[model samples]
Target: MSTYSNDVFLVGTLYGQSAVSVSQILSGAGANVSSTALLGAVLNEYNARLNDPAVQNAADWYSSYRLPTHQEIIENYNEVAALSPTEQLAIGKLGKLTSYPVMIDLGPGNVQLFTAIGLLNDYKARYPNSDPLNLKSYENDYSALAADLTDTFSDTTVKFAGLMVQKGTEWGSNNVANWNDLSQAEKNAFAVFFYKVGENEMNARLESAGGNYVPDLAGAPIAQEFYSNIEGIDSAVVNSFGSWWSNALGSEQGFAEAQKLEYYADFFEQNPEAFSTNPMFLNHLISEVGHDGLRQLANVFDWPLCFAEGTLISLGDGTQIPIEDVRIGDVVTSYESTLPLGRLQNKRVTRLFKNEVAHLLDVHGLKVTPGHVTLCGDGQFAGKHVPIIDILLSDGALVRENGDLIRMAINKPVGSREDQFVQVSYAVDADAAREGNLQSGKMRVGTLLFDRDDQPVSVLDCIQAEGMTFNPKTGLVTRAGGSPEPLYFFGELPRPEDYILRRSRETLEGILTDGEWEGTPSQLVGQRLRQTYSLKLH
Candidate 1:
């Protein structure tokens, strides 16, 4: 028989003949000790499992594994968790109704029995005194209860399962293998099944099963978007973003009310040409001007680009101090010629930075020689080169504009120069990378990062989040969320259709930057706020 059938049988027999060998072992001190209750627990669990639509549909395909004894479910978790990341992914996608069940520690009680108790508790919470096994059938011949939730697991469930599976693999010695062998459909199936485990059912599976799957403190079920009819914003996203923003507005001066109006007014007049090219600017302007302006801006862009909160350190020659530690009047290194690294071979600063001269001066500091550095003036890349007393960072290092010493990360060759102007290569934390459409490899300058409700967040704030990287010169942001993995940035201008969404995002960002904003109910801010005010420009 298949491994599934074999394992199921091993555990199933424990339920079918409650008083047999399975019972003996269960009652033995060496086993779970709740032997007598195994049969009844299994029956309840089996009935509960049947209530799941996926389980019901999957039953016929893998009937041999269905209705296994309570003991079998626990055992299967161990085997599934033991699969390679590749196989785990496969199993996660295509294992029929397989889901990572929740585990609960019930102190001194029989862990297995307590596990069943947890599942029953969950059923009670959802059905509220109603029996899961006795739900009324619906027109589709399925229960309305089943229709209430998506068959695919919620985001919380998915993240929780990932934590358990990854942790279990870490604690246990499991071989890593090429799980990619599974077809795409199979991988998708695993994700769907892995997440479908109910919060309570998960607790039961863990307690009863001898498997190891502990939940994290942060992994507790967050209401997220479970209740509200908000699009684009959920609790998870809101909580993280709101917490970050409320803390950020307190320190950021640019967010002050007066500064915001000037920032936008100057931004619009100076960037009128770019208004068509960069929709984010328009969106922010509209948000500041109110309704009609919001609509106008929405007409121009396609996605929201906001700054996230975080620190950005760029590697530069000693002339520039890292932006995080910049002090007034700090001398920075203007430029330094170093031996060619990989891409720098045979290329000078001129050829490397390319048409990027404008961005270079505006965003980075320069180092010319040892012990001497100076910051570039604002909009230096736009052909108005003015040195500032402040320090700057580029690439991945910390330095001072006074040409003082600090540490530095490796730097790549990527900048350009023309006539009297020179633009040098620099790195950007992913949080600060430009957000725009992508074409070849080049990206247009724009905002990036959004709040929980799909509203734009500040790039500065995003930098604080783990795993954000930005290449100031390259203008790229690399992000991996869910199974949808892609390096997104503002590579090119978006199509007309996307401009409205983009503009709305800009308006929300402007509003946040303008107010000394603090966290509010995310569902309300993201969902209700958007619906009521049409804050989304589009």
Candidate 2:
């Protein structure tokens, strides 16, 4: 008899009647009975109970009819196994609802019977036009299909069940012989799947399934052709490609090698010209070295430049010396005038307490070069002095020509080449002093001082007799009216008797006039007396 009839008989015996009763029923039905005829009695009893309104309770109805039991469900499942693989696949798909089943009023046993029958019927239906190799359903519900296959196969080969379920419907194989037999479209679809799943996960899945499918697929001509033209692949891109290769090969080492090949291919594709010029070096750079190495290589083609502060130089002769050894009064070669050969006669070493000199120079675009002389003017005399040009405002003193002060403003333009003719003083050496026995340690030629109007004042006229009031603050001198003509001394202190008489007379008169002096005469007399007193003290 057909497996179907055997399954039905087994089912009937388990639920419909005792084995002896089933035998009697079969005998009364007669030998060589059709499978349908053998099940007729049980089917009729089941139908009658299901149609009866008085049998409203599902459990009561099922119990009275003695419907198919768990054994019958197993038999039905076995019958499904007997179907062709294609048919089984169709049934699997049909039974594989996307969601859980809704509860119904049917008794549990009746429900089980109906479920078994439903499975059997689905298995019996004609296979659909779906392309199993495309694996659309399996891909959509991989977890469900895996579980279902494991449940149905009764073996540990469920790992490769996804491949078995594909078109051509093969079983018990872990090779790509079946994969090769698929249509081009199906092959392409598989490649897409492999690319999406990546190397590690795909390799793991294939290894679990006990398949050499990874290497076979990765080495395929289609895969090679697809990856041949990839470019601009950095580390991140390499990792992704590595993953894809790993998924295809199920081997990390194999993926790494393949990734290197792809990287070189991309490099070559992007720099065809570079390859022509220096293929060996380029290959070494791209393959054996990293970004920093490439940067070092690039630096070989660049040209070099730098600037630093220079040493102190002598103004008298161009001799370089350490800056720390420089002292005040040391003469330095002039930077102010190239025409007259001016020199820095005075050098002042100022200790800076605040601000950075280098920063200040940079800010003002000033440079400290040898023989640099900053010209300073005060009244009639202009001097060549070397003032420490720095940010510390209090460190350097202004230039002094004769006794007049020249003030240097902070915002003054530096490094200016404008020249001002001024007198320069040099230190007298002991040898020179002994040789000449000079009256003054130093000699002066240019105008030494000036009046308030900036007019040159005679150095000779500056020296006067005593009782002549000399205001150093205003650089002015006055004498009492009708006093003896003031004695003049060239570079010497004046005498007191020549200008002291008028002042003495005015003092005596003021004492007689209630100790008061009036008008211009009084004012003159008072100023003279004050001067006489000042001279006396001096």
Candidate 3:
């Protein structure tokens, strides 16, 4: 919605005459008046002048003045009926001037008359001290009157405007004469009147059968003008009107969604690495901007991210290959350090269907393969050759043994030790073997000395083990014939608390290096992640 200022006038003329002259002329315009009591008083004056005979030609002007026809009167009544409740009340207050108690006869079967009477009674009850007989008093108490009318009316705009006027402190009009000279109370009164008129007219158009109540982009200026001219109205009230107007025009939701998209765009500009470390962040980003919006943001920021079925990664040696095309023993440059070129040492694909990388690393020991793992050109892990059994037992990677994949005991604490010795076979797929297409090297594994089951065990536990000999290909434990040997098995591996901390630090560093960010560093990665991924609202 747009904002605007009210136009103020210092002096004004009516019908090419001064205010006093116009008021005097209107006071004597008997034919223009609609009050029955005023008409009767005029007739009484005419009769008195005729009987005196000294007042010659007094009846001449009265004779030429014709009362409005019944049809015209009915039309006028209908016009009043069509007016907003605030306007109707304003006009009703004017009826008191002629000492004529005008009954709002809405014809037969119309309950509007009763409804208006009930509302007026309630209004009088609320403001018992307010004068109902005087027009100036009525004008002064317009806020209360408008509030009552608004409560009694079905029209939402009138209800809204009435609420604003009641809550507002100052009011004025562009059409009022000597606006600056008017007292605060008078100005407020004028503001209430002006609002009633404008609201009535605007509501008429808005409530019409084919009204343009819901504003589009083009209607923003109109909304701005309408809302801005109302002095002292709450900003929230103005926004509510704009929301209603836009909803009526069928643009509110669309505009809001567009605003979210713009917000995400700005977020990406401010925080770049947020998308790299946290993959789930993409879900929220996708929801706000949609696939196309994500694509647009990615392009604008040169984000090395993709959500396709397959991904192609570039090696440090400038070799670009699809992840699916990568095979065991194939050398790839490492992204861990830029100074010295590092080769892919270990490679393993532990398929994760719905698991988060962080959760897997923290709860379960992550397997370190012989080859490095690079994500979006960032080195996630430097390859290091480790036995398959060591990878399964130490790194907590799922192991395939005896035609069954051995799942990690995720519930077990990292430093916890278990005395149970579970036996399993070790099998390697064709892609995972050193040379062959497929290989099966089975071994029997048993726990000799295990860590306690209460706490997480660390690499220190493995270093402290004594008198244990096991085959790397097949986890087979051997003891010298008839020799008494003491062997210990480490229970759950050490929790990757340090690794997690390092990853968090790296994520922040990536964020700082990704964009033109000059802000102070923050440890609030989750907060930054939420801001970066969530929709931006206006």
Candidate 4:
């Protein structure tokens, strides 16, 4: 039988709204089933599940498990699906709560103190005999009962925002005070303004994350990297981020529009270092900005960090070399530094990969990816190398205009991480691989597609290779060659505690007869459906 004939494609189509559905994964083709039947089966199954609120995202690639009774039928192939070491490590470090029922999520739940307080006070006045922070009340309200409630942020939330936002000069200096000097309302103002823009996601991680933090889940480490990049690039630019606030009490408008989440919409378009778009951050932005608003942002969206063929990698120093001419071990100028007599430092590149994007941002003839691998250039975060799409709030690169930071998104056209005009892509980031020091490398153009399978990868040497496929968006898996029906097997992820705790140790102890992790991140979408929507799947 041909690879496409007998090969099985296990398909799961439980994606959220605006998600990829029916991309086609047909696994069942009994001897009696025709090619038309197989096609119809896949389409019929997808249409049946089209409205199933429980549809999962397509990015999950967890290992699989074969039922004991059916294990002997299929031969030669391994008993379970396989996972890469990096993917294994990613699960342990990056995994967190995916589904919630109005419960407090310390991640995006961290709100500005002022907003929290104001909302709390409002809630209290509405219901004098109630607890303002009650989770049950919120759950009821979510179900359309009566009590209105919301999540809580660690009081420590927004303190970092205060510190990061500073009045660079007399321009906003008289009005804005250093974090310590800021009054109560001013502190709330900072938090209010920050949250108004959108979830910076990084605030919680960088604020409470202790010293032992490592490379974490998608978009987690972005805040630290963004802060580092702006600080390294120029102190004055850092000031521009907050110069607009000017002691003004924050409202829906009039905050530091400089680092606004609007600009990073472009960064989201590229999906940064993510294999596909970061689902968690993507969902959050959609909730706040809406699809049309995000679609309308033309700013930094035009500038993909990916450079075109034959572009030279610019060093912090004056020298420039053809990017392809640079090798893995070579050192390049990354970013600016003020210590040791104020000079730029050279750093080594550790990991390199091919990446792709639909469009490239040309800022004054300097082409690059927008917000991709910003982590590498800005080493304030944990990781070998990566760009934090939800940095602190989709970390941005701004230019000073009228002494205020202009959102880097200006004058950009919208694009997609899914587009494929050119493929010779390679990602260059400021990385700290093997190098203990921070600010390790520079952001250079490169390639990584948000595709599940070998979706047309272009090599720098102008070669193309067939590669395995998995979509990060929906945890969808497919193959042209594999055992037929009843032959498909998958490792089901255990409960949160089990996989996160015991499985990690078991993998280290060689107890993983099957695999280290079992479930896909996309499974959480179903979990979310069960809890929030009162929906039933099985």
Judging by TM-score against the true structure, name the best candidate.
3
* Local accuracy of candidate 4 as per-residue lDDT tens digits, 1-538: 0111100111101111101111111111101111222122222222232333122111111111111111211221121113333332233212312211111111112222223333334444644664422422432222111011110111122121211221111112332325455543333233333332222232333335542222221242222222222221121122322322222224444433343354345345544322223333334344444544433442334312245556687554567787757665677765343432123467775423344543333433444442343322211222212322211122232322112222222211112222112211122222432333222121111122213453422111121133323332332323456322111111221121221122122221132222111111111222222343342332
lDDT string for model 3 (73-104, tens) is 23444555565566655655235222211222
When 2 and 3 are scored with lDDT, the better candidate is 3
- Residues 1-538, candidate 2: write the lDDT tens digits: 0111222222232222222332243235331112212122222222333354244232322221221233432444456546654454344322422211111112211222222233223322412443312223433332222222212111111112122122111211234446656654345334333432323345466567677553354544433432331221111123322343344335655546444444434544543222211223333343433434343333332111011233344545556565445544556443344333233343333211111111112211223311122343432113433322211112222332232333232222222211111121222356644465333221111123435775434333343424454433333335766433222222322121111222122222233233111100111222334455676798
TM-score of 1: 0.17
- What lDDT score belongs to each candidate, Candidate 1 first? 0.28, 0.30, 0.31, 0.27
lDDT of candidate 4 vs native?
0.27
* TM-score of every model versus the real structure: 0.17, 0.13, 0.22, 0.21
lDDT of 2: 0.30
How far residue 495's Cα lies from its native spot in candidate 1, in Å, is: 36
Q: Which ranges in model 2 have alpha carbons more than 4 Å from their true place?
A: 1-74, 81-158, 162-538
Model 3 sits at a Cα RMSD from the real structure of 31.3
Number of backbone clashes in candidate 3: 26
- When 1 and 3 are scored with TM-score, the better candidate is 3
> Model 4 misses residue 263 by how many Å?
38
- Tell me the lDDT of model 1 at 73: 40
* Model 3, position 321: C-alpha lDDT score: 77
